[model samples]
Target: MTRPTRVDDLPIRDELRGQHAYGAPQLDVPVRLNTNENPHPLPEALVARIAERVTEAARGLNRYPDRDAVELRTRLAEYLSRGGVPIAPAQVWAANGSNEVIQQLLQAFGGPGRLALGFDPSYSMHALISRGTGTAWLSGPRRADFTVDVEAARAALAEHRPHVVFLCSPNNPTGTAIEPETVLAVYEAAQAARPSLVVVDEAYVEFSHGRSLLELLDGRPNLVITRTMSKAFGAAGLRLGYLAADPAVVEALLLVRLPYHLSSVTQATALAALEHTDTLLGYVEQLKAERDRVAAALAALGLEVVPSDANFIQFGRFADADAAWRTLLDQGVLVRDNGLPGWLRVSIGTEAENDAFLAAVKSVDVVTKKEQQ
Candidate 1:
């Protein structure tokens, strides 16, 4: 056997080693409850509208898109406020997607000497991004239930004085929403320190009962709320993301944004997607329904599941989550295995998909019992 050049060997940071992310199986299996994606596809009417708009915009492909992405930002400002978080068009800006939005936040706030503080066992991608940029990374202990630790977070803000502090509500993997008051406490202290950005990564806001901080926009120049069309809008392919903040912060993002960041096709497709906002919302309700129903069924199977406000559920304490993950895959079901040892995350799928996952778990239970003999 000969050794091939590793991706890490190509003049990259030591962090970029052979070890990679643990992702859900992306197969077209009988059921897929992984990656926290909406099980439903965009409605037919909306899909048709997107097609028409994209074709119409194709004629103008030679022309560059608006670097400022004027109309889309206006639409988002209005959409984000539909629930709460009232924001004006002038205060909003968007990028390729929220992942990019997070990176942009880091670029604008983080640098050589500056540190970035966020909760541990939260979004693993945050650690990856912060580490890649050579910024000092600091972590706060999350509560046992995975909610953001208010006192701990505040202390880190005071101690490290990190340039950026990330708060992911209805956070990833754990699927728990940090209380708004808990997040605000960090904001109050971070603002007093000058030039710190508190980003509320509300990537899964549609399913949450608690409203976004969009309405709390005014007076706090340091606050930024991040959102995405990928999750609720069924526009994952569109690579669209938006950030709400003061005009000054929005302007800074524009400066660093790749020129004409929003493609004409992307804008046209996104605008079309917005036209059927109700269709997407209906899907949200369906997924919420599935989340509750499936969680109950899993509990009945003797699995302990974390209380979730988002689309996914985290469950386990089995001796091995990886083996359980393999069992699901064997039965043609797939889910996300998380950072927490002995825990796996399952996204809410359709009725049929839910049934398939249940069946798989049933088989696993029977097998474990037999092994006891």
Candidate 2:
């Protein structure tokens, strides 16, 4: 039998014909911060408990894992409730990652004839997943500073009346968050046009200065809030993402999710992490301070830094962002050139790692690159 030599040799979906996969380039650099990951590792106590829990779960490998993920969802609800919004496990849903959670949402609420919309320069996955699920995507506008303009957003929602609307707080690449009023404005406009689902992607909310929007979920049945353990929980490898919404929304997702989609080992590992939530959260507080310090230092370097609410800062006005990005990579430092002209983003890392990144940038002649070009 002969193996296919190229992707074109096989029968692939028309939409996926020439599309590139979504991801930052994972390069081996001394200071890697391209992806917005928690730079800390799980504490030893948590690691040990994970081993113990997985051992217990291994005994049940013969049977299927819990299809509903009741315990995990219950714990997630409790975590969100600590922000002052009481939630029941029935109001929650879980998946492999927040990306999968978003995909499942598009599958359930968006389709071939449906439409989905998101503010531009936000999460790219919102559009990619919509296309994959056969939902038409609409790009909304944001201000030059990267904040969503209230009137502009309302107009877009009223005009499109998309089946699903995505709002990312502490939005990716820009690191700017949305105000509660903006959410309300968009939600009201969407309802005015048509009864639609408003999805607030709060994957980075755990690191923000203010409270979680979970409180808003109380009266807004059309709203959904998605969270993940990947960033603040420092469990990117664990791949556990969950959502809080009305019980009916949770029930709706069940129809679209694959049977036993989550593995027993993932459940065991995430449960162990939850047991150490306090210890893990301490690390988040420290990172928040570091993030602020990084922002100040970047400003001191004469770079324009966007005010960040997440564990990353977006800073640049470079003449050639791609050239500057290559310069950083040459210094054994890695940052993201998110293709937003003249801009780049750097994830907050450990103190030493951050120092190295700062030093690398200092060594590069920021003005010289533009002059050279």
Candidate 3:
């Protein structure tokens, strides 16, 4: 038999040689709260509307999708403006997902020899995408509580003077939202170092306890806010993400965007989702309530829980997080072990699903106590 070739057998980018793709475990379980996805299914009305729009788009399949995605951009702008920021279409850009949007930003602003910096334990993709784009990555500092150490961040900016900076509001895994003052301070510090592009990953902003940072875009040409339909819209499968930024930034991104990158079907589906925004947001309210309920339940279990502004909660001070995760899995519940040492994360599922997860946690506690005895 011929020997099987391994991935390392062929020459590949040295940076990607040993890298693992970013993902949570996708397992078949009764209560799966691993991925921070909106637990609610889209309403029937929205589904019907998506069908209608997609059907219309099918008629134009022979032709290319609007290369600039003008209509979709306009609708996205309108949706964002509802937050009172008055965003214009020219200042918005959409891509397959926030990942693609992040890649485009890196392609335009970060490349070989340039550095991109993000506080530790942020959206990992910031560093991953930087490496993918041939950009150097720098890890900045965060407080022990998972909040950005603003002064330390300023100092990092001064020292490295990276070309790009990434800030994640309502940061993942930890579920901590950055304060507006921190953002402003970082932006100022980044600019002081050089005219750096400061990108804010606001993918969870819709679920945040605080307001969206869109309003801060005024006169800040280097500032960009990236958002996604995957979370609040209950449309993770939609794969639509957009960014609000200065017009010039949008133009720069155009320089690197592939022609007609977004397919017609995606634009139509996203358009339909926008039409039913109110109904979808109603589900967001439900998730927010459920999130709070689950957080309280977890804290009541005597576990350490990080105050979250996203749909997921980060809880634990487990001596062995991996063991705790496996125990939950054994109990037919799945959650994320984000490699945060003593912590594990769980997305807020439906009321019943959350109840099951609580029960599983209680069981784990019982087992641990018995083993000690």
Candidate 4:
């Protein structure tokens, strides 16, 4: 007997390169609400600043960017301070994106027989990344409303004794945050039973009425908050995201990361992004206003709209959400279909775009998709 050749001879992990990681599509779509990206464009002034800085770095491309982006770290620490979660530059570390940042956290703390844990219907990336690290991932069951069950979470913690726990506030897909007390309880349970790192992925926090657990981090050394410029800041294309944790923990991450993990051009762009925090935050306010409007409209139309604290709304009562997802795409108003088979997730775009999506929904007899299917 002999092993198969070529593709068949490759490692299973290598074979997974072209496969879906978190069910996100890479195709170009007119309305891309499916990816939870901010619809706002980068401000002109900020663009100019980024251009100036990137041009300055053109001559330095022959050499690597600072293995540690010290200037960017200072800006990020100041940014976090303004948001009420005070931090220092020494406490922050970043990678290409929050996706990779989380991967670093996993590599430092999880893999093999070790376990990674999270709550159900939360960020799918948590489970995807955990498996990519060769770690066993477990989750507590979700409630009827799709939030995690606190008691179930405590039990899961006791059982899995996970090395890392990903807690996504204003959790993806469902669009509701885990309550503060709920998060606190989980932290206490984990600390009592085992040493675990609890990471709060606050990637969408700016759009969520400014509520964050970063304030709870001082005494909770085991907890960390990860942020991304991809959401409300409209920097997804640049792929910049960071982690804020104790210096000791940050040192652990720094030990394993590659030199020049973020390019000089990328660093220049992020530095410019920090300068426009106020302008970008104004956009977040606009999105929150739109989020409320969309939720109310969906409720009026007899859909069960989840009370969302994030920039998107999740509605129940679809006859077939998958078909509706395709219909929305055909109409150039793409949104995610989640929360079981008969629910949909719609991102809050600019008013004009939101109007177009709402009108498209009203025009369609959604049941038609089911009939055709």
What's the TM-score of each model vs. the native?
0.93, 0.97, 0.98, 0.92
The local distance difference test score of each candidate is 0.80, 0.90, 0.92, 0.82
* lDDT per residue as tens, model 2, 107-141: 89998999999998999999999999989999999
Clash count per candidate: 4, 1, 0, 0
Better model by TM-score, 1 or 2?
A: 2
lDDT of 3 by residue, 1-373 (tens): 9999977778988877888888888898899999998888989988999899999999999999999999999999999999888999999999999999999999999999899999989888999999999999999999999999888998999999999999999998788998889999999999999999999999998889999989889989999999999999999999999999999999999999999999999999999999999988998899999999999988888878999999999998777788889999999999999898878999999999999999999977666555546
> Which 10-residue span in candidate 2 carries the lowest summed lDDT?
363-372
RMSD of each: 2.2, 1.8, 1.3, 3.1
lDDT tens digits, residues 241-327, model 4? 998888888899877687778899999889988999999989988889988998888777656888887878887566767777777
- Give the RMSD in angstroms, all C-alphas superposed, for model 2: 1.8
State the lDDT at 266 in candidate 1.
86
Choose the strongest candidate by TM-score.
Answer: 3
Looking at candidate 1, the ten consecutive residues that score lowest on lDDT are: 15-24
Clashing pairs in 2: 170-177
Please estimate how well model 2 matches the true structure, expressed as its whole-model Cα lDDT. Answer: 0.90
TM-score comparison, 3 vs 4, better candidate:
3
Q: Which regions of candidate 1 deviate over 4 angstroms? A: 1-3, 14-24, 192-194, 366-373
> Model 4, residue 128: what's the lDDT?
83
The alpha-carbon lDDT assigned to residue 34 of candidate 1 equals: 82
Model 1: lDDT to the true structure: 0.80
